[model samples]
Target: MTIWEMLAVFAAGIGAGTINTIVGSGTLITFPVLLATGLPPVTATVSNALGLIPGSVSGAIGYRAELAGQRPRVLRLAVAAAIGGLCGAVLLTVLPPTAFETIVPVLVALALVLVVLQPRITRAVQRRRDRDGRTATPGDRGGPLLFAGLLLASVYGGYFTAAQGIVYLSLMGILLDDTLQRLNAAKNVLAAVVNSVAALFFVFAAHFDWTAVALIAVGSTIGGQLGARIGRRLPPQVLRVLIVVIGSAAILQLLTR
Candidate 1:
């Protein structure tokens, strides 16, 4: 890669890390940049998953204060995430490259819809809970439905990442009684687990570009810190709009390519 190309990938990494920390879908930024750099689709996906590990962990650490008193809930959900992530990682390796290429745009489109609808979904869930006379406590682990939804999301995260965080946040918002920041903190932890597990699987089963990994890791690590600082303060609508614009761009690129 040229120096310029390397810089672009690094910058994308930073954007992805920050966005992932804020609302998820960092892959929409990094994946397209990696593709533009001429990396193959599967290689880009594997490398992106491996590279974002540090950033995910950093984001979680930055949210340590919000994570307080959420240990049991986080750990319980983590088991489901780990299991589903492993399954998704296996699916990636078992399928041919063409399958990944064909499915990615569809997945990205679905992710964008979820991102766009997240606010409405939250409000609807809240209303339903109120109507049903159901209340969520901080200690609530979100029951079986939440567990099942998270498992599916983790599977998708393991496969392609992208807006995995948004899926997580939406599910938690509906099922758990917690502040957005606290749910975001938990999202980071789940993302970290899914990425780490999938990356580990790729290490033994798939091809990787170590240069891409290194560049993204360093850049995302820095972005993670930046995200934590601004995420809470940033308006939700702004983040949603940003994600929609970038995600739409990614979808267009994938289809046009």
Candidate 2:
């Protein structure tokens, strides 16, 4: 990669990691930047999975305070995430570029819709809390459902992780009993698991764009840590809107190209 590309990817990593610490759509930033750097679609996607592991790990650590009570739920969700990651990686290696191309539009559209609607859904959840004294914890009826969502999200993460945070937060909002801060901690961990295991598979089995991957990983690590440190303080709605806009433009560019 050129020095310029390297800087761009790394810078994106930092921004993405920061955003991911609070919200869930960091991949939306890094993946497209990787593509713009002249890497093939599949190579960019695979290397991205590997490169962002550190960022996720850092975010999880930053959220350590919130992670304490969610061990059982995290572990159970991780099992399916690991298996699903492997399956998605295998499919990625075997599928042709045309297949990936066809899927990108669909994935982006799905994420867009989910991102658009989640606020309304969460607001409904909040209204429930205001009206009734009852509260839902992560381990309640929400656990199984959220776990299932994680597995599916992991599978998609393995395939192409753009708006994955939407799915993660959507599930966390339902399953977790902890404060939003704590549930975010859980999001970082589960996201880390899915990315870590899948990244492992890609590095050993798939040829990578090491230049872009290295830069993005380094930048994302720093960004992820910084974001985690101030996740709650960040203007998350502003960031999410920015993500949606940037990600939407990337999809349009890809389509129009």
Candidate 3:
């Protein structure tokens, strides 16, 4: 890569890491940047997945305080995410590049819709909880329904992980009966597992650009820390709007290309 390209990819990584830590659609930032740098679509996706792993880990660790007492919840959800992620990685390796290119725009659009509707969904959940006379408590452990929902989400995460945190947050908010903060902490860990597991598969079986990986890894690590500090401070409506704008841009980029 040229120096300019390297700088661009690194910058994209920082943005991705920050967004991923704050919300969960960092791939939308990095994947397009990698493509703009002249990598093939499949190669860019694989490299992006591998490159973002460190940032995911960093984001998860940044939420360690919120993760407290959620070991059983995380572990249970992790198994489903791992299996789904492995399947997704295998599919990515075997599928034609045209398949990914054709489908990704649709996926990004769907993710955008989810991000836009998150607040409405949260309110609906709150109403249901009120009607049911239930309150979020530390003792809540999500059951089979949540596991199934997470498995589906993880499969998508493995396949194409833009705005995946939105999906997780929505599901957790509706099903798990917890604060958004705690659910977000769980989302980070599950997202990390999905990405890390898929990255492992891609490293062994797929094509990737190592220079891109290195730049993204370093930049994303820094972004993750910053996101942990700054993302929490942003108002929910503002963050939702940001996610919509970014996701919409990703869709436009994909469709135009």
TM-score to true structure, per model? 0.86, 0.80, 0.87
Q: What is the C-alpha RMSD of each candidate to the true structure, in Å?
A: 2.6, 3.5, 2.5
Please give the lDDT score for candidate 2.
0.74
TM-score of 2: 0.80
lDDT of each model, Cα atoms only?
A: 0.86, 0.74, 0.81
Among the numbered candidates, top lDDT falls to: 1
Q: How do these models rank on lDDT, best leading? A: 1, 3, 2
C-alpha-based local distance difference test score of model 1: 0.86
Q: Which 10 consecutive positions of candidate 2 have the poorest summed lDDT?
A: 170-179
**Model 1 residue 114 lDDT?**
70
lDDT of 1 by residue, 54-136 (tens): 99998898888889999999999999899889988998888875665576677667766776776777678778889999876
Candidate 2 stretches greater than 4 Å from native: 98-135, 138-141, 234-257
Better of 1 and 2 by TM-score: 1
- Which pairs clash in model 3? 25-163
Q: Which candidate wins on TM-score?
A: 3
- Tens digit per residue, CA lDDT, model 3, 130-225: 999977666476678878878877877887777677777767766665566777778888989999999999989999999999999998988888
